[model samples]
Target chain A: MNRRALLGTAAAATFSGAMPGLVRAQAPGIKVGFVATLSGAGAALGTQLRDGWLLAVKHLDGKLGGLPAETLVIDDELKPDVAVTKVRAALERDKVNVVAGLVYSNILQAVFRPVTESGTFLISANAGPSTFAGRGCNPLFFTTSYQNDQVHATMGQVAQDEGYKRVFVMVPNYQAGKDAAAGFKSRFKGEVVDEIYVPLTQLDFSTELAKIAAAKPDAIFTFMPGALGVNLVRQYRQAGLASTPFLSSFTVDESTLPAQGEAALGFYTAANWAPDFPNEVSRRFVRDFEAAYGYVPGTYAAQAYDAAMLVDDGVKQAGGRLADKAALRAAMEKPGFTSVRGNFRMGANHYPVQDFYLCKVAKRPDGKLATETVRKVLSEDTDPYAAECRMR
Target chain B: MSLNLLLVQLLNGAQLGILLFLVAAGLTLVFGVMDFINLAHGVQYMLGAYVAATLGTLLGSFWLGLLLALPVSLLIGLLLEWVVFRHLYRRDHLAQVLATFGVILTVEDAVRAIWGSSPLAVPQPEGFAGGIEIMPGLTYPSFRLAIIAAGLLVALGLWLLVDRTRAGMLVRAGATNAPMVSALGVDIHKLFTLVFGIGAMLAGFAGALAGPVFAVAPGMGDGVLILAFVVIVIGGIGSIRGAFVAAILVGLIDTLGRAMLPDLLRLVMDASSARQTGAALASMLVYIVMAAILFLSPAGLFPVRRG
Candidate 1:
């Protein structure tokens, strides 16, 4: 074949190649591909995730599951098309045994087909969209992160329990935002006086703040992450609505707390894991992460670190063998992996069945904002859509 | 919405308008007088905020930081013009856009490298940090009111500078006919450089003012840049007055539309449909107005047409 034809043949091999990413018996080397958004607006989260993943690699002495492994990390740049293309390249060109590390839901959903259809095990460190938690669940896909709605649902339950009779909901207008609102409304007992879906890129919340003030809700619940989150929280306080008791889910994270400064103080939130979670693994992870990186790891980092650890456990269980997809998948599902968030188990749909914690932003002894896990809202909870997942 | 709510929303719109005007004023003048399209203009805004915030931490006072940031931002703007933008002045708009877009990427990456990707907090200036009661049972944030006053002051300053000064007359003349100004013993190159420098300073000033309210991050300028462009196009390419009018118009329409559309739609439609349609329509309202204005007057609302 000509050179162009040879390239085309290799490209075609991605589709027609028999059980595309089966580990070669001769090589027996594990190659894991990580795709996360490491650039653009919300890149700090991706950076922390990459750092945690790398720290896991370091802790393992450059081995996963007691076998020598190679990891290739790529930036998706927060674009779905770019993520899809990069994953394809990772599978086809690099021919990795496993794929991991996605921070955005839309990008994860975009790359789900290509990564899974190639018979490559895809472990998501973050972003478990609802589509994959239900009837659409794929056997080849596994998520170390909670379903996207899990934290929001916990917050909803918290708001209901707190006796907040009137709540104003605010979130960006997108799929994740819609999912968040739905999650909150499903469990919130209060009357939703107003549910405002602002544009995703909107930075100024004065108008929204004005509207919230007029409505005079008992509490304000918002799901804005990254820069938008920082902007919203700061503006909320600036608008003198700080007295209204702000609540959120993953919007006032450790990554954004510095930017929020004093404004983030006393804000209520819910998430799967926090730095102050009382566990040896959590403490060690947090300490080692801070010592190694000179900053505390947020939930994204914790999640990615867990993903790496889980992958390591799976490899160890498989006796350094991931060539058999079923064997590896079964191994990953086993309990007692020493996760930073303790006692993690995969539901039938492959999303985590873990505890969700109600958290608050408090200043640490060192004068840094950190999430303190106040109470457990959902213990060993599985997603609602897990019953719909046929993979069980 | 109640009358008080309406009034608040209008104020919100006006505040947003003034900020937009601050950025668009610089953008329109540069496009108008120099005939240069600098996509990196937004990055100047970003740089201003970054400088202000960084210095604010180092200086221990927001006012002092602002005082120091202005000169530093102006210097950086002038340096950018000297090193990168001067070469692009003779290029076509597409080439200028492509080159300046490259500058945007470089500047944003440079910012990320220097000051990580996390947003930075810039404390609001003292005495304007909280809200105040303007009427019975009504209170508004003092910082926003301060922003409005400052923006209007800058607008007035710009008007006086452009309309009342000899240099201003030259700029107006240059906007109308650069070659004629050049033929009349005026050094158009210096004029262009000065205009570019002033535009950068204006954008940076706006950025510094906005740092307290908005998230000071690497790509924060991208959104405002697009809106500033819209303001200039809708108002008139070369007219500062056009930019001012259009900036406020765009701001009010955007703010008020987003605030009131769903409620208005709820009166006629079901709640769910009203919300969905209202949000969709509200986002498109500004563009729709732009389209209608363009259709009605192809030269824009205040085109700088000379007989």
Candidate 2:
């Protein structure tokens, strides 16, 4: 009797699975494989991105472009090999129509080929590596986030405009870090006193901080992200180096400011958007995000919300015809939805041509720490690498 | 490097070494007395920081939080030994390693579930909030200096306890021959539990102290664990004195290498490539030194004397 009951259930399950495909053909639902670093030290950024994307979907009544949307959130664990393997599974096993969300550039570099080779619509919420922005640009790839180099370049321009003759630069020794150094140097034609590259896992910066004090440069520019930034900012102040102008990108942002506390106050960073962006979309996002997640939305969250909206608009424009790659690509290129960053458009390379802002860390009225926009630094700034991108 | 820079770097390295010593002391003792490869040892350090940060904020006093965390850490260690580690004591070394590694994963996940993955802030104590001029044109954080001094005090207290007490004698005997000590009618199991608890407390202490200076986040202990392992291996496994000397040596080498290698390489190569290669090489210096020391002395620099 038990065997007979099991057989009956199995037959019912097989029939129910077939029912989804039959229904899917009538109302073309979308499946998104959201891969991000949801665990380990970098998990904070990944969590923010994931939450932001989910919040956008929730705002759309749990559907993208009037179709039922199903998202499979996968934790990359910040490991390259793991990202490649899981992304492959998401593409092949799950047959996800769109792949979105990655926090680290290294992970993006690892999964880019497998994703693009399969001809899937890859929407990068963050980690816009310079390699893809330039000659390696693919029509299949699109980034809601600005190119990595472009944000770092803003700080470089700031340093130069402020008449800083000598600058001490520090970044993690990785592809993104190298790009940051190159980007900064492209704009600032000054003597770079020293460029210290620390390991990604390094939490202590006492030795490097010592070197900075000895050099006594006009300013210090760094690109340490996540916990690295947290430790560096606090230690910099503790070591009495706060007197030196702390110029950075992604180092003194909303995600890290909570841990950095008063140490990050008055420190400057450059980004495309902040929590205090003065617009209806951004204001609504910050208010809803804080109400939902109990934390201020950072740039990671803002960019990811844009990525989801882009996908939603793309699907809407394509009339839910996901299989038509060209139509979907064109729809995504000119995203119809209002961006949180008011003036945002896709560049020739599929990266954002957006205004950049110089932001300062400030304590909010409710005593929460967040980044506030100081002023606009670049208006409709396209990445330098776009000229090299010959997108087919 | 200039004289001022060198002096500050030295202090930084010494502070790092002191923290490594505190963590390694417990690790070495557990390994030596029990012959158990406790890969989960690092999680104790992480737990220490987490408990301190949470309680410190709650009670509004870093000192009170630190004081309360020690007993809590001790209780957690004892509970872990009773629940999980006791069963694994009779297991083989590979089994112990695999099991303890499982513990590390379980604890890391639990931490994330409870505290979330973001780093927690542990404010510096009131008195040690700023830097003091250690040398002309060079200032160091007083909190770091306090850490170094506290570590030294702990080291001295540990020495007195281990070298000048009856419990210390039993621990030495157990390290030499656990079976013989058992045969001599000592409660070997109790000794094992005691050593394990103490080791956990020491590691927890280090973590709590590190909270104000370093990042208090999940998996924060993993990197320190690797360095502590290196310290024990290079110091001669199971020797506190050896762990101390080796920890300081490793710390100085790592700190100085990172600070000086790039500048040194610039003399022979272009500045950009030199910085790149130097950063790569500096990270490798610790492991390279470990290999060299292991080659020179297979049992490490100061192998515990066996009867």
Candidate 3:
């Protein structure tokens, strides 16, 4: 064989029945591959996804099929190339019938092609990019979380109602960040003074904070999560520019709250759930998690826990049978389970049409980092992109 | 923009540049002297931040945390060299990168497993928390000004140490002629360990110092590592003076570019388009600058002991 042919042969060895990864007996079992950001700064979200899914697996005794099963989990590392490779391996080598767990919209986009081609059902735990909800929505692909824009829409409602006359918007240099700024604009009826875009994983923000300060807007709205949030809070506080109200989505949470401390005292963060949600499931999970992990679980963890419960309940409702792929997909569609978020239901886009809550960081009487449910910012919040979905 | 705001941003840019210098200094030297691509160097920086955060939490004093974290970081560096890095000394750059990459994975995972995924931070020392007036209307954060001072002092100390001390002479010699230095019966192994430890200590100190400014999170060092690599590449690996000059250049360019690029673009394009285009361009400016520098000078501005 020529060099190209030999290379192709070696590559073809990955998917052929003759490959070592192809297992005959486990073919009937539901092979669910989870694609998530498991490395780099993106690992924070992936870690939460892994924990939630693993917790679900533990509760279900590693059996998702109501029968023998195998779960193929690979770290996409939040890179496009990695996602494509992982998706191919999962479909060809692992022969997974179902795949889930995406933290970023971009990664979801990269892996969706391979997933759709293989007829594999993709259950996105997070990252409901607008495109996928409507015209771009493939029947084989479904989002388990809200569309990316819905979270920002929640913040927009709050901003418009709060009577903030002028605002400044900040987001990472990425698709969702742009969508977030645009999404906020969609519902907010206010003049935006400026928009600052920082690179993802940017730890220093004094310069940007200075820009926001100089703009002197009524409120500052941003969508930076995990480490980015922590950096922004510290820089904001240090700059002695605390008078301006700060509102954010997915930026201020248990993961970043500890780093911000008193600096996070008044910042308002929009989220679908808070640990303080007065529900048995929420309380139980938070208490158990704190007891086990010391730190309070973030909203990412909550969503993760919810996704697992949704899958678990769906599998059980399907007569404890995931033997058939279509039956499993059917069971998942009408998932009947209590999530950590409470009263969970999947929408037509295979995403959640859930309520968005405004959470403010407030120290308890004992002075530990805690968040209070300020109000339901947006009720029955649905992704704007879902209208484009033409599910076959 | 208000004069005070402009002054503060400028100070912030300078402070960031200094911190970059502290990190890039050791990285440049290690690559220059050892001819080893030590990717795990970033972890030492992260470990410094973590050590400081952990100690501050335990002792309730950020200064004490800073002092303790340095030695801990140094100890980690030594331990790493003894167990892992020492074996790779004779190997090529590929082996070193892979091994150090393993170190990064193991250390990062260990940090996550131990510290949990939540970000940890150390409070800025109260003594250094006050703002100082730079001009009639402008004031800068005391902690940040202190970083500039600390970074400058470290830079001077590094120069003196490398130029005036016997160990420094050996290192300078090693960078040029590793085999000859080893043949001279200087106990090259011990020297290498010492160099590695000091390099680790420098990175750690930088991390610990930055803990108050930046959140101590897992994989925080990855970005810094890339930037440090760029700095070393442009400054000439293993050259302290080169790293210093290059670090400041990179830092100033990055900070100023991010601040000014959009405005500059707005000159020709619409404000909104300019801002968006500027943001995308600003992100790539530092890398482009690095590539430009490398293209012009393959061995960097100051090629250490190599001719």
Candidate 4:
């Protein structure tokens, strides 16, 4: 070939390669990037999420909303910086139209700017930081999980409805911890005897248990997650407070109940979704998840599964083009899909306005640990901060 | 606080202190005698816990887990010493730190790969699941009490071994002057291997014991590892006696500070601010104490050279 023709062809190839998504727009279906904590501490929750999400995609036969979809799952390793880097790469390089699967609030907050700036529709499965629920809400962001404070608030209301007068609360010392306590106090009519905050990673709670024992409060409420929750609850039982009515929020759940053994039994916790939620979608999900993964799916999994459904519905509403951000966002905000947590509706802020169930850990007839939905504590609950969100 | 609460907290502090000592004993020894920095010492503790939990589950008895964990822990330690730690001994501290840090990453990832990164319950041995009333209205977990008793027994055994035995004498002498001990025709390499093995066993023992009380999961050792370092630093780097004292002090300060600091701060500040400041300060309590001690005594509280 002539030198000039060869140079022109080379330049054309380079330009098309740099802008692959624009050049080859309609060939591949919707691309969704999933980033979550898949490899570090508390990774069980992340693994459940990844599994649940993939199961949904698998069930749909690799198609989301009647369109061929490509999902790339990446582990954030529970690090914010890693999450940012991965999300950025997913957006800029992979050209994913949608991003999902953020389990921790800190991670969601960290990757918020980059994901939104890239104009990718970010649907969070687990984490729903309050910052994003309020004035900080972005049009590009949506959450399938409850706001961080909502469950604690529901637990507090449940405590009051159950006629617990004097309560002692404990939580890991962080923003979420403070929010938890504040949320509890918001609706709780009873007197809070004491509120103790410990290091988030503290494994040993003998001294605190002793204090709880000494205080002899009517009920004990806490918001410890992962191993911390396992240790604290087990230690509490070991301290001979099995008779004391213990309450928790996101502390004793499906993810932690296996390691917690009988210690978590009989305690009450509040969450937006549970395996025994009675809805057809939830029943099918829980049964299929157990059959596929050997263990029952936790709240994290349920939420992530719902997130996948949301993306599917959004893609359908957008006529199989998730690149149309406005239509996708509008479809996502509408309540149509049969969510595992029934009666699902998105608030103006893009966070779910759903019922929070007060669940009690009980042994099933077959002798397996399971959470029985006792009652709905909050009905069609909208986050208090949603009013401040100007997403409309 | 009431007198009962105070007494219980003091005992809790002692219990935590002893656990810290069990993990720190080997770390201090390795650091002191060999002049080696093995950050992977914490991973040894983690491996010990995992081994014990797995064995316990497989054998269906906690006692069996304990019985088997010691030798396994020692073997792993010896293996690591032979393959990786031995080479780093002659290198600079920075090299040792980096290499050991790499070992830490590898060990943590390996555990995660095997166990799937979820917390596992190491079943408390039969008859240790309940609490014992130590005094009027001051009931504590029987398992924790047993941990305290076991930790003390280990401490006693370690004291005798280090202070009265021939091997311990060599270890102590080596800590003071490694070259001088080597010049005396002592097989320094063999001695280091033995010391490393024993240290690994002690840390493993601690981890196994801690399995029932703490959550058995990957990276569980990292937090305790930092605390163990603080214990070794506060207690002299090579001084077993110093570690004993410093570990107890750290345990008490940390426990009491977390329990009492917020209440104390509430007296001076608003309730919310008190909690925020108190939690921040409580976390820093041990480091602060370490700094104060170092400022007062540059050589740890019980320097082996002085001993």
Candidate 5:
């Protein structure tokens, strides 16, 4: 419509034709796609991941390595097929050179191979399965989160250090659940009373709780997150066993902790990040996030924040050129992005080899629920399976 | 293990049975009376749990929350039936299923829009939170026993209403032939509304009862809906007595299979193998029972009187 616009379009076309190589030399904005379950049972965690990413991008003021950035977000709905298809669309249609934000290990496994094989960069915010941390690791895959086994292994170490001799293990019957159990058993050298594996979405835990109580272990450890975590904590409290020491690998996050309230009090949990880690970056994230969102950010948010920062560092390292996939990835391999969890370095397997903190819920000096940094459970904890990762 | 351990497992099995009966009772009635398959019935259960959690959190009392949630859920259930479910009454099973499936999507989304998709935990009553030692060595959750008692009471009340009262006569007759009941000067639409509302209330009640135990989140109804359908298939679609007994049987078998099968397997194998094999077998127990029942009695133990 405007005479000036038509003239600009004609001149732009002529200019683009004249300098084809100039386009490659110029600063190109990075396009990244994020896929996760954004509308189902795990939707809250997914939203947290999304928010963290947006906040990181917001902090960057729409720039990664001095070039503007664009993000493509898709909802996976917790279905493997849908997640895979979404990844393909983001890569092929959206033309995003890098993909990030996988919440579940199952979804990550469904996503990792396709993007890696296609020579696209995948920056995983969460869900680094041991296989990918180990023999299945690919050069294109980089996880900001620790391997799933690393967290569980640290949990086991916490239990062992606490002098727990008899423990009952419970996890939903699934691949990840089995992995959680095996990883814990690898580090835990105590007497195990029983291992009860229930269906993934089982609601009624009365029978299972009875069995757990019957085993009468010194302590009970479980691996159930999302809805399962809420259900288990509520039912465990209802089972009149609150006094019993409960250890969990993936529970007691900001997402579930508020809903749990006093019920989560005194529970021991292990994680790579917590709100009270005493780091300036983490403290600021907690303070500002609490003031803004009216709730604390969980590990889900923390991992996602790290993921975005990692991408930012990679883009900057590549001198703002995301089109060169290997150059951008090589830039990502060296770590200097200060995440909320302090400086995290990528290990040989592409998963973060970071510190694991054994934390217990206790009322701080102000009578607000916060995690007590019980101990640095593992320093520079690397996955045993990582040696098998053949990432070039 | 020991005798006390056996008693505890049995008690657990019975508790799960009672809860399943509460959910199955409504589903069987809806199918048997109206010849309508309502897939969103479980969504009402989710609504009930949500209402209870939000109300309980606001009021700081579990019982009060349950009380306040009942009317809200009932009104919601009736409105949904009037606006959505009533239209599907004349539709075929395929159409009804599709429409109700849409309802599931709308309701789950509505919950997410309102509650932000986080699992909300409703605390148990102060009194019922703890278990009671029934025997010298065995203790069972008092709240679970209360559930069993409540389920039995509802079952008895339903039996009296369907078998002993004049309204019961009409319902039974309507199950046999709705057109004939309409010919006797009763409005069929009114009957359908009443039946749908009651079925929804039962589902809401089950949802309410389960709130303290399970997290109230979007799509929590899916697993429960599948189990309730299994109950209907085994108990006979329209028969209330069949629903109750079949619900209990299925619940017991599923729960006990999960709890005991692995230990029983350990009688012959090592603990690890027994755990793995038992976990798999336990999950398959209910389906296996459903298959056996279908094989033995083609139309369930008691078919609806439509034929």
Candidate 6:
């Protein structure tokens, strides 16, 4: 064969490789980058968030709005640095139109600026720190979950209504933990006997439990998540603190209830949603989630499912044009999707303004543990930080 | 803190120390005798808890599960020693760290793949299920008391084995000088394997005991592993006596520091600021103690004398 013929054939092969890429760029599709702590102590929560989001995607037949969707799942490994690095890659390299799924506040804070500055929509499936909900609120950032303080504030209200004279507060030492303590204190009119701030990595709660016993408070309030929650609940029961009312948030939910078992039964937790919500959307979500994942869904999953719906509604309203940031932002502000929580709307700060429930751990007829909504604690509750938000 | 709270905190600290000692005893032995670093030592503790939880649930008896888990853990230790660890014995510390870290990732993923990411429920042994009255009003979990007792028993047994037995002497000699022991008509590799197996079993035992009280989930050992490392560093590597003393001391300091530091700081500062500052300081207490000890005695509190 001639040299020119050989060179022509090589050039044609290279052009053919480039042809599929050029054609795919013309197709109408949206890409989502889902980042969560999928491989450590917080893996269960991240797993729930991912599963719920995926289930919603599945229900929509792998399409968000009218466009086919491609999701790139990245495990943050529960590290802030890792989250920022991966999120930057998602924004710059993968060119994901939407960045979603962050279960921890620290991680969310780490990736928030990187994602929003890149002109990408950032949706938080779980973490909604007060930092983002207040004056630091961004037009590009929105959360399907409640503001960090909202649920804790619900518990504080319950304590006040119950007329607990003195309450002992315990929370992990971090931004969210501090927010939880503040939230609880903001509502409870009664005297706080003691406020214990344990390290986030602390799994054993013996010393804290002993202190609670010593203090002899009317009720004990704590906010421990993931493995920390599991250990605290079990130890609290074993230490015979069961007689003291255990009022908590994110401590005795569906994610930890399986391990907690009878130890967490009747424990009070405040949340915006539970697995046993009577709403049609929630009922369907819980039923399908259990059927698919072989475990009861938690609030994490519920919020993530709503996040997917919000994204779907926004995209649809924008007429599937992801590049139209202004239109997408406007559409997302008031997206018309029925939330699993029955009532969910974005407040001025882009955090959910919704009803919070005082839930109790209940055993299902099938012997699985789940949280049952006992009563509505807060109605149409907007975060306190929302008032400080400059965004209209 | 009141006298009652102090007593309870002391016991809690001891219980934590016992658990830490179980994990550290093996770690120190492995490090001292083999001159090898096993970052996956924490994985054994995790596995022990997993095995106990799964077996206990299946067998319908916590005691039986624990009894069986020890052998299974020992076997796992032996298996790992045979497969991954033996190959890396001659490698540098950095290589061992990298390789063992890989093992941790692999085992954690495998656990997640098999059991899912959720924490598993491990039932407490029936007799030790409830809290026992330590004082008139304050009560402590009996299961935790049992752990303390079991740990003391193990410590006594380890003391006997190390101080009085022929195999113990070899282990000590190996820790002091592996090459000299190997040249002096003794099978040093065999001694190293035995120490490794025992260390794995001890970690597993700690895990099984912890399973009932703590969350039995993937990466549960990672936090404890760091504490265990601190225990060995403070206790002196290869010294079981040092480990026991240092473990208890470390535990008491951690527990009491966390419980009282905020109140102490409250005397000087506002309550909220004190609580925040105290918590931050408490988390650093262990390392601070380690640093102080290391500064005072560069070889650690109970340094093994080198030949």
Tens digits of lDDT, candidate 4, B1-307? 9887888888889889999999999999899988999899999999999999999989999989988999999999999998998888889999999999989888877776666577886767877756778654445777777777887887788889989999999988887787889999999889999999989999999999998878888789999999999999998898888888999999999999988998899999998789788988999999999999999998889976733
For residues A1-392, could you state the per-residue lDDT of candidate 2 as single tens digits?
23322332233223222111111222357888888776676777887888789889888977887788888777787889888998999899989899999998889989999999999989999988888999999999999998878888999899888999999999999877898888888889998999999999886798998888888899999998878888898888888888899999989887788788888898999999999988999999999888877778899999999999999999999998889999999998888999999999999999999999889998999999899998998899999889999999
Looking at model 6, the pairs that clash are none
Per-candidate DockQ values are: 0.41, 0.47, 0.28, 0.43, 0.36, 0.46
| lDDT (10s digit) by residue, model 2, range B1-307 | 7786788888788878998999999999898778888888899999988898888888888877788889888998999999999999889999998988988878887787677677887856767776787654456888787888888988888788789999999999988988999999999999999999999999899999988888888789999999999999999988888899999988898998998999999999998999999999999999999999999997888899775
Q: Write the per-residue lDDT of candidate 3 for residues B1-307, one digit (tens) a residue.
A: 5677666666767777788989988887777777778899899999999998889888989999999998999999999988999899889888998999988877876776566555775766868766755543223568887788899999999999999999899988988888889898988778888888889999999999999888888788999988888888888878888888888888878888888898889889998888889999988999999898889989899886573
Tens digits of lDDT, candidate 1, A1-392: 23322332232223222112222233456788888766676677777777788778778877788877677776777889877887898899989888999988888889999998899998889888888999999988889989878889999999998899999998888777888899998899779998888887797898888888778888888899889998898888877778888889879988899899888899999988999988998998899888877777998999999999988998888777678777888888784488898868888899999999889999999998898988988889999999999983
lDDT, candidate 1, B1-307, per-residue tens:
7787788788888889999999999999899888889899899999989998889888878877777778887798889899988998888899999989988887887777667778987867877766786433335778778889989998899999999999999988988888899999999889888888889888888898898889999889999999998899999897889999999999999999999899999999998778877888888898899999999988788998752
Decoy 1 TM-score against native: 0.93
**lDDT per model vs. reference:** 0.84, 0.86, 0.78, 0.84, 0.79, 0.86
Error of 6 at A375 (Å): 0.9
How close to the true structure is residue A79 of candidate 5, measured as C-alpha lDDT? Answer: 78
Chain A TM-scores, candidates in order:
0.91, 0.90, 0.85, 0.91, 0.88, 0.90
Error of 6 at A33 (Å): 3.1
Q: Taking the candidates one at a time, how many backbone clashes does each contain? A: 0, 0, 7, 0, 2, 0
Mark the regions of model 4 whose C-alpha exceeds 4 Å error after superposition: A1-27, B135-138
The better candidate by DockQ, 2 or 3, is 2
The list of candidate 3 runs beyond 4 A from truth reads A1-40, A50-100, A106-122, A138-142, A288-295, A308-346, A365-368, B1-5, B32-37, B84-102, B116-118, B121-126, B130-139, B166-189, B236-239, B290-307
How do the residues A14-40 of candidate 6 rate in per-residue lDDT, one tens digit apiece?
322211111122246888898866665
Question: How well does candidate 5 score on lDDT at residue A338?
Answer: 85
lDDT per residue as tens, model 4, A175-207: 788888888988888988888889887977877
How well does candidate 4 match the true structure, expressed as C-alpha RMSD? 6.9
Among all windows of 10 consecutive residues in model 2 chain B, the one with the lowest summed lDDT is B130-139
Per-residue CA lDDT of candidate 5, range B1-307, in tens? 6687677767677777778888888888889998889899899989988888788878899888888877887799899988998888889999999999988987776676666677776766657756786543234667777788989998998889889998778888888988888998998788777777788888888888888777777788999999889989998998889988888888889888988899999999999889988988998899999999999997898777573
lDDT of 5 by residue, A1-392 (tens): 23322332233223222211111222356777877556666777776776677667767876656677777666677778888987898888867778899888888878878888888988889877776877778888898988888888888887798899998999889888898888888889999889988888688776777777766778888988878887887777767766668888887777787667677788888889887878888887777666655556778888888898898898888877667777887778886778788858988778888899988877666556666678798998888887777776
Fnat: each model in turn: 0.50, 0.51, 0.44, 0.53, 0.49, 0.62
Model 2: lDDT of residue A284: 96
